[model samples]
Target: MARWGWASFLLRRLTGTFVVVVLLSVGVFGLLYLAPGSIQQTLLGTRPATPETIAAIQARYHLNDPVAVQYLRWLGGAVSGDLGVSIRTGMPVSGMLGGRLSLTLALTGYGTLLAALVGIPLGIVGALRQGRTADRLVVTAGVVGLSAPPFAAGLLLLVVFTGDLGWFPGYGAGEGFADTLWHLTLPAVALAAGAVGLLIRFTRAALVRELDQDYVVFARARGLGAPLVLWYAMRNSLVPILTATGLIVTGMLVGTVLVEVTFALPGLGSLLVDSVTFKDVPVVQALALLLTLLIAAVNLLVDLGYSAVDPRVRLGGRTS
Candidate 1:
């Protein structure tokens, strides 16, 4: 691999980050505006507030200003790490998010790792053993995993493992690491299933395409072992797989919300859902923004990762 120059790479990554942040801010602002009711109702009570109280709340939240002004104010505050106070909890939004963010991150991060570990190998094996029994079995498993909804899987797992067998706690983060792992096992598998299957399919397809490429045939003609040639081919084939995985990872974060709700886990997903339901604007905004940032960061990393793996991708006009 060519040396990836730090200065140029950072510049490229920062540029992309800037663009994504602007788009995210715009999107969030639009969603807030499109929320049911006027800014007063969104930031204040539905009961007719005394004019003085309404004015005070508007001033407090910057709602009295023009949309542009309000956005700029929020943007400034956001840059300063102030997401404002949660209307529902009467606490700082950042503190509340910080409390729950780790749980969601743990669940999603570990589940994604498990998915990648299982899916990539399965895909490689299935592709190599195409038309054989092994391929059939792996493909069948992928199909089932892909087709099953996570919430349904969660429910079924709860019934079989927790309800029938009485083996594991159905919900809550347990007291210790071992207990936590036990509780997380079902939800993690439920969250990972669809993503794992998608990655497998993508990897298989990419591998198939890569094997047909002229370079792969040339490598084979040069007397490379099947495994060696396939490994090289897999690396080249992984661009699409990497891209697909990035998207699936982001999608899993969304799915985590549903999984959390179903399993009664107190992760950021559940917190966000609760905030939305309770009309806790600050919490809702903070959670949404945090998720957006996480997704954006992943996408940026994916771009950099692609440039690292493939010489064809450029960073700062340099073939890296």
Candidate 2:
């Protein structure tokens, strides 16, 4: 890689982000308009729209314009932080989302942290003890985790921990930082479970592949200890693990909906559900864009994280 690799990579990512956002914005707006009774009926309520009234409404919201024009117009406003007002409550979409942002972030953040903490280590251990009972046990546990989807796992956690054991509270996001974290523990665990399982398998497979490479054999032949050789294998295996982690993070963001509903947390996912239920066009559009940007941003970071993943990888990756 050249020194300009980082710039080239970042520029490429940004351009892709721009294209995706444009297409997504167009699709979301167009599809919403096409959906029967999604916005028109919701906006009109039970009363029929007279020609004059229909014209006025269309003019006001730019509904009469072509989709491309409408998208560009909306895009202009969006770049400046104006997401428009929520049709349901007349609240600024940005403000509404901001209010619930922290809790949702906390939940997803905690879940990702937990998944990494639990998954990576177990994966390492499994790889080291491949074909052993411990490896089989780890694989079994991962299957169990993946089998119990977030909602079911959440419910079970609520019943056993909150109901029987009385170890944690059942609902609400709680108040204050400490209280919030305390409240989110079970939900986070439930959210992290599937991700943990995925990471375990991904990490194990990656490490195993890396360990079998000629480089690892050469290192061993050079008299480096097992620990050092294993460390090198682990380091080389990070690209896949990081890729999986990025996906997990994005998945957690979207996956929060069911978990929030189950745990009664007021996050973006729940907000999105309610917005869609009420046919709040502005809120839904804003959220769709937000989630897309977040996912794109994570992928960009992961891409940047490649050679940058381990500085030693810079020869082939960015930051050379």
Off by over 4 Å in 1: 1-10, 46-48, 315-320
CA lDDT, every prediction?
A: 0.82, 0.85
lDDT of 1 by residue, 251-299 (tens): 8888898899888999998998888887877777777778888998889
For 1-320, candidate 2 gives per-residue lDDT tens digits of 46565566667777988898778877766655765764555555445778787776677678877877878888888888998888788789999999988888889999999999999999998999999999999999888877878888999999999999999989998888899899999999999999999999999999988988999999999999999998888888999999989989999999899999888888998999998887777888889888888887888788778757676444434233
What TM-score should be assigned to candidate 2? 0.92
Q: State the number of backbone clashes in model 1.
A: 0
Q: Each model's number of backbone clashes? A: 0, 0
